[model samples]
Target: MKPIITTERLIIRELQPDDAAGIFRLDSNPAVHEYLGKSPITTIEEAQNAISFIRKQYETNGIGRWAMVLKDTNEFIGWTGLKLINTEEVNGHRNFYDLGYRLVQEHWRKGYGFEAAKACLDYAFSVMKLEKVYANAEKGNTGSNTILQKLQPVHTESFWDEGVETIWFEFQNNKIGS
Candidate 1:
């Protein structure tokens, strides 16, 4: 598949049905979901369902998280991209574009998250012509919080999400990477 965004070591593309195994490997790791506030999946079927839902977002909303693959070995690392948040309000905002990324447990802390996220942020602002993009990380997830900070969002605030303190960041098209 053609990559929607390519980094030095990663290729970001639409999630495919064949990625179910990779998705399962990612979402089934308890350590990965520690700050996501979501339960780990127990079955490949659940991962397939998750892929279907993300694919539907691409059709219904024009964008969704894309699979992150290694450029050298063509391995599915995880997912990274934008999600159009129109169905629910997060931090009192709705109908916005959000940047997100998830990686396999072994891939954590190797800078892939930041690499993929920065590429997606650039895409959202340039190709998509989006005015702004929002991202949130659980307060305790230091790695994620740090990456969001590096993107240099225009504004930030702390809010409660299901009893967990989360930091919300807003990156304006003009202020990104500044």
Candidate 2:
């Protein structure tokens, strides 16, 4: 599949049926799901359904989280991109472009997440021409929060919901990394 965005180590492409196993490997890890307040998925069918939902967003909105594959090995490690978000459906977020990323455990701490995120945000601002992007992380998830903080995202909101507290961050195209 042709990639929408490419970096030195990764290629970001639209989700596909073939990415089911990758998605399963990513979301099925309990450690990965801990900060998100969800449990690991036990079946590949669930991963397929999740991919279908993401693919639909591309059809309806023309943008969605994309598959992040390693260029050297062609491994579908995970996904990272801008997702069109609505406040009603996704609590703590207003209608805005949301920056998100998730990866399988073996790929963690190697800077792939940060590398993919920078490329995705660049695409969102330059190619997609978005004005701003929003993001959130659990207060204790230092890794993700650090990624957002390093982008110099302005603090948006800190809200409590469903017994968990999360902090929202925003990155304006003109002010990113300023």
Candidate 3:
């Protein structure tokens, strides 16, 4: 498939049904699910279901996570892209697009996460013409939170997410000048 975004060492492309195994390999590991408070998928079928759900997001929301493939090895590393989130804030706030990424443990700390994320943010701002994007990390996920820290600060707030405390971070599109 043609790539949606390409980084120095990675290819970001649409997720496909054949990606089920690679996704299962990434999401099924307990280490990967640590920060997100999610359970690892036990089988490929479950991963397929998750992929189907993400594919629907592209059709309905005009955006969704894409597969991240390593350029050197042609390996399916994980996923990264924008997602639409609904907020229950009492002030009439509703939906917004946010950035997110996940990669297998073996690829962690190799700079794949940030490379793909920075590319995604660039695309969202310049090509997609989005004004703002938001991201959040569980309060204790220092690794993920550190990534969010690299961007300019908007505000940090604590909230209960599915009963767990989390920190939300927002970023404005810089477009060309930013």
lDDT of each: 0.94, 0.86, 0.84
Which one wins by TM-score: 2 or 3? 2
- Specify the highest-TM-score model's number: 1
lDDT per residue, candidate 1, 23-137, as tens digits? Answer: 9999999999999876999999999999999999999999999999999999999999999999999999999999999999899899999999889988988899999999999
| Tens digits of per-residue lDDT for model 3, 76-132 | 999999998763541223598878999999988887887887788889889998888
Say which prediction, candidate 1 or candidate 2, comes out ahead on TM-score: 1
Error of 1 at 178 (Å): 7.6
The reply for model 1, stretches above 4 Å from the true place, is none
Best by lDDT: 1
Q: Candidate 2 lDDT, tens digit per residue, 1-178? A: 9989889999989999999999999999999998987788999999999999999999988888899999998999999998887635445456888899998989988988888887877877888888888888888888888777878875567777677788788787756662
Q: After superposition, how far is residue 135 of candidate 3 from its true place, in Å?
A: 0.6
Clashes of each: 0, 0, 0
- Candidates 1 and 3 compared: the better one by lDDT is 1
Clashing pairs in 3: none
How many steric overlaps does candidate 3 have? 0
Question: C-alpha displacement of 76 in model 2, angstroms?
Answer: 1.0
Which window of ten consecutive residues has the lowest lDDT sum in model 3?
85-94
